[model samples]
Target chain A: MAHEEPINYYEYLRPNKKYPNVWCSGCGIGVVMGSLIRAIDRIGLDKNDVAVVSGIGCTGRMPVYMDFNTMHTTHGRALAFATGLKISRPKLHVIVVMGDGDAMAIGGNHFLHACRRNIDMTAIVVNNWIYGMTGGQYSPTTPLNARATTAPYGNVEQAMPICEVAAAAGASYVARTTVYHATEMDKFLEAAIRKHGFSVVETVSYCHTTFGRLNKRGGVVDMMRWLKDNSVGQIAAQKLDEEEKAAKIVRGVVCDVEKPEYLDLYQQVIDRAMEAK
Target chain B: MTETGSAENQAAQPVAPGTVSETPAKKKGPRGKVTVFGTWCKGCGICVAFCPTGVLSLDENGHPYVEFAEKCSACHWCDTHCPDLAIIVEPIE
Candidate 1:
């Protein structure tokens, strides 16, 4: 079968980087990074025109590999730095990458405020249910009964569904997809990148090295299969009864609505001040 | 009966050095080509494990290669899932 020229993913990646990324074998962070790169490529965005910011975690390391204007910020402060960057460089497409612990745990305040402010930026949260970089500690999104290094007897605390939190916090765009659903993740990421206001895309990922081994969840294949078997599209989820839906992760765009963006609204304030002068 | 026992043994045996039987060779199926950039591959086995069709397998060094090109469906799962960006899949012309 004749085919178009295959895309060289390395073109988007840093050329001088050594072989193999820092992520563990079968870690879902790579899949999410690939999807994000593909989405940016699809939109025809110039690498120079994009600013990728990340907090400290496995997810935080993503920007270091990309051939874009990147910044690795302090732990749980990616969005705060991204907000400042977006405000100063309104023309640049700011994308923030954060892990579950970075986004919803210590960074919870920044995450909520970023959503409530409705800034013109894209926030991609990789929810791996555990803090893989910090040695598989239980995170805010780690489900009840899930095993983590910090939660040896299984977590008694409830997990926070990030997409729902984003939606409730007034993000103009919110969606969720797993690494197993690569194509779907690409599409959702593309849409999230295109959204004008605060957009949050929660990528449910797996940390097979730490989380899987501790939980006895097998390897990469088993974890990917679990994601495939457990998640249901939002529309399909609505049709199911409460019990059926309870066990299934609802994927797809949870919320999307147009609203005046933060920076654009901020511009109005400047205009009023000028008029007063 | 002898064939059945041998087949079971083949299946049960751990992946050994220089063994090419990781993915069953399929003669009649959609064919594609998989290219692995050796320098980029981390021997993760993610692409091999997540492949919907058993078209990929890791060599002794843990680098992945297309073991059964004929079984490829051009799903691009391996291409997308490779953490190291080492693998690319394209339909054979």
Candidate 2:
């Protein structure tokens, strides 16, 4: 008989911190964390071989709970740190978790360049629309006309489609899924981790305490139901008219292509220079 | 709580190899056993509200429990949605 290891979710979690996470009662960050853990467990990755890095935000707290090579970097600098770490230790699987503001607003340049560099790293941007940790400020991903603490009347600027931006910047794997589609999010994360080049998985999360209360969205369940109602799979989305499609969040693997990763290319350049010498 | 077995009792059953399956097997036995870690549960009610077959419900204390194990198809909605990682679904032989 084959001896099977017990599947305990807590095994991946930090043993020191007792259960009952610090996030709000209905915050979706925990759900995203669960997806990440499920993905790692599904992939059977050795915890020592994995490194989880995060920028300062509610999402940044994600690494603290996980039993991995966790690093909490400065605000909006997770990608910069993760890039350096990935280049130095190419063997480790690096995952960067950032909130919307961390990824698109403060670290926008780093994010673009990281995708452009095509480095071997997976970025899971937990987009909760509003900056939940430092009070509800309007973020780069906040939908236009939505009410945030910063946007008392309504947000005038359009929301940034993170996957589209990553795809355009040349990320080899780019996918978008909401917290409501937890299974799909897990699969996307697993695929992103397995991919050899830079990958981006934008998890459309909800800040129920801030974004929900400000917008009068009932609660966590209501927010989840709204996600379910508003989202459409990419394939199915292709059939809808422009007007119809505009209202729905396109969820699926947006772009996936094989590309030469930065570290591997750099090594090849060094090898060529040595051969020439 | 009266209807379902404890985690130890459930652990005694044969273990399934992977995370909860997306597709339920067409087997005739009980779909699977779901165990909730009471302390870990934050009373979000996500698992209870989203269980497609209505297999889970919050007890008086707000922790979810398998209210109807027979109806559980092992679809894993509760397993995936539990923000606290409080629930685990295992296949029963």
Candidate 3:
């Protein structure tokens, strides 16, 4: 019966000499990690078949911690590498974990192309708005008038809508969830992975050290509180979209559709070649 | 009497074990023939350590290049946990 209880993440995580996690005490990355591991264990896929890639940022360090096929690629380039991996080996299931700056800024182009191509991969962007890894510099996803290390006087640029971008770029599946919605995160992640083409699951995270303190977001509790207070279902969020309702955050699967997958298409070419010569 | 997320009715379940990605594994064709990719590996042995079927091993640099091929269950632990993002899992067909 106890075995049925969710697997203990802390006990079985990839053994690291760095016992005390480096993230801020309330950082939700730990929770996200726990949920992901449990989901993978349940999916019945051989752990060996899964490749998790990450870009440079706080979240980039996540792959190093996970005991999976992982790569810590250059900042904002995790998707590009993952694209190569998925295309070169269409059989592989490649998932990319990236941060706001890495996925939405310098790596923006690759992210879009992956969606457009509908590459066989899943991208989980941990968006804390500001760049938490580089001491809270203003990022493209940083909200309008938010303070950052670079934006000492508050940011003038409006944050880009990542899920909208994903949808616009033709990601076959697009979902937005938050750390506060731990339950939803797991469900969305599972669905995203199962979806055959490019899937972008944006997980809004908390950055107490930089983004929270500099902006008015307060601490971890405040961030979680925002998630709870602003939570709305997909149906409800859709209604709001019609009525122009605006909440601090919305959580649900935004898009799920069938599209021509890049890797499978490449495999079709191989299939044809075998038949030809 | 039913197990939660126990490989049945997984869709309606609020949370199910998710598909682990990016490790290595072996797949048997209809005849059980297996092929392995030795390069594209960083030699990290998380796969060797996590294989529940006890089917994979490490060559040099801790990469999972050593394989007997026949004993493989195609469990995919090696494919899932290879730190270099190497390894591929597919049927030989």
In terms of lDDT, which candidate is strongest? 2
Residue A18 accuracy (lDDT) in model 2? 63
Q: How close to the true structure is residue A156 of candidate 2, measured as C-alpha lDDT?
A: 99
How many Å off is the CA of B61 in candidate 3? 43
* TM-scores, each model vs. reference: 0.89, 0.89, 0.71
Q: Candidate 2: list runs displaced more than 4 Å.
A: A1-6, B1-30
Note each model's CA RMSD in angstroms: 4.2, 6.5, 16.0
lDDT of 1 by residue, B1-93 (tens): 999999988755544322233365445555456777777777878777777787677777877766655567666777877777777777553
Tens-place lDDT digits, model 3, residues B4-91? 5565565322211122223334454321122334543333344455455544565545545434444445544333323232443433
Worst 10 residues of 2 chain A by lDDT: A1-10
- Which model scores highest in TM-score? 1
Per-residue lDDT tens digits for candidate 1, residues A103-152, read 99989999999999999899999999999987989999988999999889
**What number of clashing residue pairs does each candidate have, in the order they appear?**
0, 0, 34
TM-score-superior candidate, 1 or 3: 1
Model 1's lDDT to the true fold?
Answer: 0.85
List candidate 3 stretches off by more than 4 Å.
A1-4, A10-12, A238-244, A273-277, B1-93
DockQ of 1: 0.40
TM-score of chain A for candidate 2? Answer: 0.96
**For candidate 3, what is the recovered fraction of reference interface contacts?**
0.00
What does candidate 3's lDDT look like per residue over A1-277, in tens digits?
1012324344335775354455665566655665577567656556678889998888887777777788889988999888888777677779899888999899999988888999878899988888887788899998787899998998999889999999999999999988766657767888888888899999887788898898777755566667767768777776676445454577777889999888778879999999999
Q: After superposition, how far is residue A169 of candidate 3 from its true place, in Å?
A: 0.6
